[model samples]
Target: MKYSREELEEAKRQIDSTLHKLRETIKTFEAKEEKARYKSQITLAKRRVKAFEIANYFIEEAMEK
Candidate 1:
């Protein structure tokens, strides 16, 4: 699917926001006293963070081209 420059820019902004929130969530989960209880949730958030980072990289590349 071909995305326009404006659309790609908006998507990048949204992904950036989501990535920041996900990182904060991971930090919060790790800081909890019973960190083991949220282990699965933390892992899920970490995976999402990685995915978003990859997506952002693609978006930037698209914009460059």
Candidate 2:
């Protein structure tokens, strides 16, 4: 599938927003002592970070094309 520059830019923006939200959630979970909650938040944060990294890689690839 082919993506326009605008579409790629929008995807990058959404990923960035998701990353920011995950970071905030992690910070909030850090203040609590619920092990399950903390663990879940950390897992989500890691996933979000990974997603953002992947999105960035795609953006770079798109730019190079």
How accurate locally, in lDDT, is each candidate?
A: 0.97, 0.81
lDDT of 2 by residue, 1-65 (tens): 89888988888788788878877877777777775757866887878788788878988798679
Record all residue pairs in model 1 with backbone atoms less than 3 Å apart, i.e. clashing: none
Angstrom error at residue 39, model 2: 1.1
Off by over 4 Å in 2: 35-37
How far residue 26's Cα lies from its native spot in candidate 1, in Å, is 0.5
Q: Per-residue lDDT of 10-46 in model 1, one digit per residue for the tens?
A: 9999999999999999999999999999999999999
TM-score of each: 0.97, 0.74
lDDT of 1 at 59: 98
